[model samples]
Target: MSERETWASRAGFILAAVGSAVGLGNIWQFPFKTAQFGGASFLIVYLVAALGIGLPAILAEFIIGRKANLNTIDAFEKLGHKNWRIVGALGLFTGFWILSYYSVVGGWVLRYLGGSVTGAYFGAPAEYFGQISAGMDALVLHAVFMALVVGIVAAGIEDGIEKATKLMVPSIVVILGALAVFAFTLPGASAGYAYFLSPDFDALAANFTDIVPFAVGQAFFSLSIGMGAMITYASYIDGDQSLFGDGITIVFLNSFVGVLAGLVVLPLLFAQGIDPNTSGAGAVFISVAGAFGSLPAGQLIGVVFFGVVLIAALSSAISLLEVVVSWVIDNYDVSRPQVAVTLGGIIFLLGVPSAIDTAWLGWFDTLAYKFFLPVGVLGILIFVAWVYGAPAIDELMKGSGLGDGVGITWLWLARTLVIVAVVVTLALGLQTLFLGANPAIIPPL
Candidate 1:
């Protein structure tokens, strides 16, 4: 067995986990997805999924990873039946798929970061976005992003990963906080709030089946669940930490960031006199960029917004890279440099179509989010709920302030509500992705 090294401190572990959670999903995808789904109603469902389903499941994975002190496959072998080991491997595979497309998106954000500084889209935002949103140019940016990700992972986990996340994640939080506050004070801010918060419970109830799966997918996305990123990152953790406490905190912060993003994007879009809904899933990027471009100090704020996203993205990408890197080094005894090249090369090839084509990019995004991720998370929830049972109680109880009492209650939740929610969400995600959004069945928007 290799020697285990914990997070150098508790703050380091908390920040890293939160860093993973607060990526493109929360900061980039959440606002846009919410706007598409009827604003605050989507947020309400997302909250329920996060606390009821996401937190408990995350705690379960962290327990297994930390207790076993290894990557997901070995972690399962330590906790449950020999058959269970493949569950973690599936998670690892999902993480690779996620990073492949994720780097493509991250590269776009990096390009926008540079674009923001130069007022690249100042006059005609839509045309500029159309030009770079896909094609060979996007693929080149994707390669650059992939190379940067490969370089970070090549430097090893503790030193390269931790140091960068430590510096970057906090800046993301701070800038987002300030931006949210600033947006809130803009004229017509109440309209933005109303756009986001004034829920049509009828729309929600009518679209419950439709929305619930998205919420669950969003839950997986926001909490960084299912992909073995959590499990792999937790494997590096020392024994002194509380999985439940950290799990709750990471979920809280990530959800908050998502909400904050809605606040920042909605009000600013309304204030800029652009239809907030027009940008669709690309709303946050375009609306915010357009908003910044119109402001008194527009260029500076544009730089800040885009720069912050770039930092947040890289922090998340590093974790995805680590999961693949760990699998290679642990299973094959591969050198760090070679593993980086091997895994990076495979992802680069798999992601090329996504980088070069908008349709392929959308396909990867929808398939991974609405299909791959939920299925991956569903497997985790089921495995934890039934397979591990008593051992899960013991693992959760470890370093838990409440011990068996808290563990037993959560175990019951894990068995009942968590499993049901994940299954339902996974089913919904599959339906939506394959069948398309049947508005007649969903609701008359």
Candidate 2:
């Protein structure tokens, strides 16, 4: 057997994967999606999809990754067929596309982190975002954010990247938690919580067809499914621990972070008399900035809040970078530094359009969640459900503390409901992106 690298600690592996799973998807996309759908109605669907849809896909990826003990590319090849290798390669491709767009946004978070301190967005959230979100400013910030990720990768996985995630993940949780507590003390916080928790079920039922697909896509993309991020992260697992259990923990943490973010953000918005349910990707930025401007200690809290968001985003971006980095290291046996530089150069060039064109940001985000993500996840489900078949279940269940007899239950879902549902959802979701409800705008990185 070839020597394989594993995480030095289980906590490190779990945190790294969780960090990947929790990101702007949670802090940025989740709330906008919830508002757009049925508010409370959408939230219910999101939770179910996270458990039913997201968890199974995660376990499938972990099984393939751990069983083959290879990065996405080599993992599928080791599965025996030349055809299987493409499955892994597809994952890497999605991962690459995701980073091209995602890093650009991570840069926005980097800029906002400093802005929060400098009171750059103090009185005019709209104007501040308008000035900073697109054009040359966005491009520069994207470059800075990409550089941070590339630098960590260049320094090697253990010393530079993983260690940073271990710290960043905890800070994310602590800061988000603190922010939430602070929010509760705000004047209208209780109202904010009510608005978040209470759903307009009638509205949801009416819009269920259109809304369901988005919720499913949210569950899939928010958890980083089908991008090979989980598969890549699982490649580092050594303990014959129940992948089911670990997967559950990671998913729970990811979902909790999203809810926690809503808790912190919505209450503050409500207290500042901003509606919690607003439209557009810019809604939170607009609302949050206003809240920061009004509060007595808004600047300090804004710094901490945006800081947590930045940490969350950066940690997740590391996971995306690692996916490409690990694949290069595995296939070419190239030094980590070379892999980082090579991939970083490619991503930097690719991300230019995303940073410069704000419309491309929405398009890419839609394309990833609505089209590429579900399509890729369906492929993974097919491989595990039919190609790998019963053996995959046995292997996945072994020594997993998380799911015991649940193995049979999960395999059944993967074979039957999981793929079928994802395919249908992907179709409708893509339709919505290309045909319905999309606005033409320059993408803001």
| Clash pairs detected, candidate 2 | 242-400, 245-402, 357-443, 358-442, 358-443, 358-444, 359-441, 359-442, 359-443
Q: Give the best candidate by lDDT.
A: 2
Per residue, candidate 2 scores C-alpha lDDT tens digits across 78-155 of 877558877777788888898987888887777777888888898788898888887899999988988888887676
**Each prediction's Cα lDDT score?**
0.79, 0.82
lDDT of 1 by residue, 115-217 (tens): 8878898877777777776777778888898888888778776677877788988898889889888888788778888989899899999888777877778
Worst 10 residues of 1 by lDDT: 436-445
Candidate 2 lDDT trough over 10 residues, lowest sum: 436-445
Look at candidate 2 and tell me the lDDT of residue 287: 83
Instruction: Quote each prediction's TM-score.
Output: 0.94, 0.95
User: Candidate 2 has what TM-score?
Assistant: 0.95
Q: Which portions of model 2 show Cα errors greater than 4 Å?
A: 1-4, 401-404, 437-445
